[model samples]
Target: MADKAVDALSENEARDELARLSDLLARANRAYHAEDAPDISDADYDRLKRRNAEIEARFAHLKRQDSPSEQVGAAPAEGFSKVRHAVRMMSLSNAFDDEDIDDFDASIRRYLGLSDSDPLRYTGEPKIDGLSLSLRYEHGRLIQAATRGDGSEGENVTANARTIADIPDTLSGAPEVLEVRGEVYMSHADFADLNARQSARGGKTFANPRNAAAGSLRQLDANITRDRPLRFFAYSWGELTAPLAETQVQAIARLKDLGFQTNPLTSLCDGPEQMLAHYRQIEKQRATLGYDIDGVVYKVNDLGFQARLGFRSTTPRWAIAHKFPAELAWTRLESIDIQVGRTGALSPVARLTPVTVGGVVVSNATLHNEDYIAGRDSEGNEIREGKDIRVGDWVQVYRAGDVIPKVADVDLGKRPKDAKPFEFPTTCPECGSDAIREEGDAVRRCSGGMICPAQAIEKLKHLVSRAAFDIEGLGAKQVEQFYTDGWVKEPADIFDLKEKFGSGIQQLKNREGWGEKSANNLFDAIDERRSIALGRVIFALGIRHVGESASNLLARHYGTWSVFESAMLEAAPMEGPAWDDLLSIDGVGKVMAQSLVSAMNQEAERASIDRLVAHLNIQEAERPATDGSPVAGKTVVFTGTLEKMSRAEAKARAESLGAKVSGSVSKKTDIVVAGPGAGSKEKKAQELGLTVLDEDGWLELIGG
Candidate 1:
């Protein structure tokens, strides 16, 4: 039987769908925002979010705390210092078609209690397809710049922002305290040039202009950003000490006057018809535009009206992004290939007959997973009307500004008579190890561990990735070559390259791609990274769930490599004070902790880590400077209802003061703030003889 529509779904079905959407959207946000790599197309992501919203609207009680409707973006990536936005940076809700646009206008009018004849104007501006940046100016001088990370906090990129020519370092006649919010993008010509240069130098190339812009702006080194041709378009404001103008269009004009690059095509539309007409005009000119714009954003023209309309949890009600439709093409599925990631995930790729989608020729598209190919989602809901994909079948491919194309639908009428359902592999394709799909997991993973060449090579590549060791001239290609040639099998083998192959009959200089100068440069780069920070070292290990941010959190919590190593070794059995302490670190969950422990306690992995450590000097993790703050370096736990503030507000405040907010109570917990309805956690805190405070007490302690 076909699944019911979202409105017709039962309470249980709605709850299950909500859970599935939440997980998928969370992964999508992390890939797009934190990693600068989008796993799904914009259209598919928007569709899932729309379905999630419809279900939530029908069954409000089934709405999850971590609903897609409530999240803005992923948490900020590691390596850069974080900045908390004075005013939250909100995302815009999307409108796919003309009907959605009409409904949007009508809903705004209804909410404001206005008639069709009411003079409600809107400002339509191109929505730049790039990274969102917030530039803060104090006394007409740029003081800080940050990426829009998780809405509330962002990564500090002031140095990189200073290098962009379009972003003025000093603005004349600007507000004393102004935060200009805009999009940082790369022009078409610049993007092509950058890719050419990257390809020539054997460096990683970007998939699109947006990724190029995001990667360039988020660089750890400012000089790299300075060389990249990045542009900015100021379309909004945040935390202004004084209003720029009474209306949106006037405010944009004022921004342009203040030496900011405001979008030239921004116009004031009298009504929905005019707004949509302007959208169509912009769409027609999209091909000629020098930069990339995914859509047009429409906002209420009157500043007062916008304030009255107010904001939702993650988006503003006054604005919506009228997105362009995804480009689609029909192609034949030539074959299905399984590729293993560093984490051993068996991702399926559909090799397709060459076809043009959105002006780009695509020969491969993402199958997502076996379940996706089987025409069902993780919750067993049918997708593409339960049409299973097969080799040699005609498929509809879609491209929505994504790096990879996606198989949107399969045409059963064109299916070949001999077509057969794809059988997912039961063993690793590279190492022949048993591949297992654990309960609740969509992708199957290889059990070969270090022995699997695919996983091993990918892990080695990840060890030297930009966010990890970041060795110059040692990218994915070089890592793969070294691994295949038996020159490097593990992290420790990399350090031994200079000593073992520096001067011998089989020398690095004798390699096909290496000269004396280049070989020495590689050695120097490897040597320079011998004394890396603890966070980078942890990230380079390539633990299953320990990403850059999680690695940094672990490094900060443990302080030193020896301490972290010892704790993980002790926590391997999954019980005891060490395990409890590991679990007590903020953002460290049972799954992450288990992964860390498994990697650290496994005999072969431990030996490899020991060998790697023997050849390097690891620095202690830097602690945030809190000076005289009472909660600095303390671990706090909040339980029950907080009357003074929301739980999120309390956690943010605590973290700002250099405190860790753990989700659970343990003996290592420094304090527990209890409120009405506090039960087990309160009792546990008392039992452990930890400091217990009420909501008022917490406020008093924090100097409210």
Candidate 2:
């Protein structure tokens, strides 16, 4: 949105913007930090976050608990087990120039009551563009390694971290239990070679060394990581049983002596001036460093001084990252294309004239949506004063935060005389279905449903996803090929592949990429999942608005497919007692109920479900035992806070005891667990004379 419009937003507009910003920022954090594949440029992220903060400051009462300001990054991605860190791996506050560095020094000295002549030593080193890793050593043996996921807990990447040659398997003359923290990086040469190999193999190549390092380190297959040229540099320690040295520089030296790599450019700077000088030197040598370095990190050299400096909520006071400027270059806008996602949302992508940005060839950039291409907001407000982009126009592309090539600026005077505004497609490019835009929605979607080839292919991809059917030896490529070859067109066809090809003339084993052992393994994998969970079956259907959690809710509520299917069929008429009943279930909203009923009402969708059900025995969702419990089957609401357990734990416990946990207090609420700072729900419960209990009372009643 334009700056003037943003400032002039009404309260309702502010509320909507806050919600959009929260969701967008959360998704960006997950893509960048957890999955290591950022979807948006850093400039776009900063712009939205700054807007969110401004709105919150203007409207304090509308601030949400899960606001972007309170979060560091998202939780770890699925597949790996979680590991809680003993000490938080906090992010560093950033500084842009020598002035910011001076301000940082002044703030530190002011906090520590030190004079200008205190002679405090600081270490300045290049901040390697890579992924953060924490290696835990127990009894002088490397036991575990984890990613820095949301600071408190992380994904277990021990196997992948062990593949890097720099990380030793065993440590001699070390602490009984020590956790070493460092960066896992890929050098520029290694990155280039890896991209060259990826290009040759027609695999996805990374945009930068940092992404290559992160993607390499987070691999599920350790064999893939082992083949990548990955290295590590230990710069800090976490949860040490014994101290390595009295100072940060000394500890780094000790780590290097213990057969670990450390940044050779690290130097002890006497003050801020020396630090800035070192940063300048590193900035000058950034091009020839043979690895990516986005900035310089300055930390207090003395460990004791750092210990006394303490920490803010998200960053430490004794350290700061001085970031270098972004890389930018001008290129011509060749054309624009619309890419439809699995959910039917049509996204616009820019096809640019190939140009180098940060040593990576840039051929495309994200146009975000129709509004972005039109230089307008969803509300039709002009962004950048209604200056829309067109084909053959000169646009400046930049890498803002070490990743994602994006168009940052445009030269309006250089536009072609015959340049015309690009027209976003109103019909699905794949199936020519009418693309629709709902009220208050940002993007347009295809109305063709499964008939749209793009959406159908994506849904097929999701059918065998890890959280769903998870058929091994059958990945995206196999699924696509099977669909094209008419071997597997729907979820049910996956089960019929073996029967069709058992002794056929054209067998799957005879395919170009198939052999005996692999084909047999695939068949065995398919056979093993013949008896599936009801929740998995629901999730595998890929219905709109139905995720794993929602499927589980539906599962636990109905217990079996027969009951669930009957309820959906009854509710398919769209408004009656059955619709009310579906909405009465906790965690199920109107949108979800509508989606469930509508999906069941569709003839094609229901026919596919019938075929899938005929092939397997879908097990009922098992609920926790709640025998002889008075709260069993009661609708309850918990307000404020619980002292003994977290809110999530409390909700799970209540659900385990067969009590339905609702979000608000109502006439049907059987009980209200009100703690300190209880709000309107507690008052409503009191007005209705409902049973309201404290945390202790809840524990007593649950027999905890």
Q: Which candidate is the best by lDDT?
A: 1
How far off is residue 177 in model 2, in Å? 8.0
- lDDT value, residue 376 of candidate 2: 85
Predicted structure 2: clash tally: 0
Which digits, one per residue and each the tens of the lDDT, describe model 1 over residues 1-704? 01247766766556656655665676688789988987677877887798888887897655654578878887777678789999999999999899998999998897788999999999999999999999999999999999999899899999999999999999999989999999999999999999999999999987778989999999999999999999999999999999999999999999999999999899999988999999999999999998888899999999999987777768998999999988888999999999887778787889989776675456877787788899987668888888999999999988776545789899999999999999999999999999998766666889998899998998898788755787877877899889989989999999999788756224777888888888888888899999999999998998865666678888888999999999998898899989988877766656567878999988998899899999889999998888888999888999999876667668878988899888888767899999999999999999999999999999899898
Return the top candidate by TM-score. Answer: 1
Of candidate 2, the 10-residue stretch with the lowest lDDT total is 60-69
- Give the range of the ten consecutive residues with the poorest summed lDDT in model 1: 1-10
User: What TM-score do all the candidates reach, one by one?
Assistant: 0.71, 0.70
Over the stretch 127-234, how does candidate 2's per-residue lDDT look in tens digits?
987888899999989999999988888889999988899999998888898899999899988888999999999999988888899888889999999999999989
lDDT of 2 at 549: 60
| lDDT scores in order | 0.86, 0.81
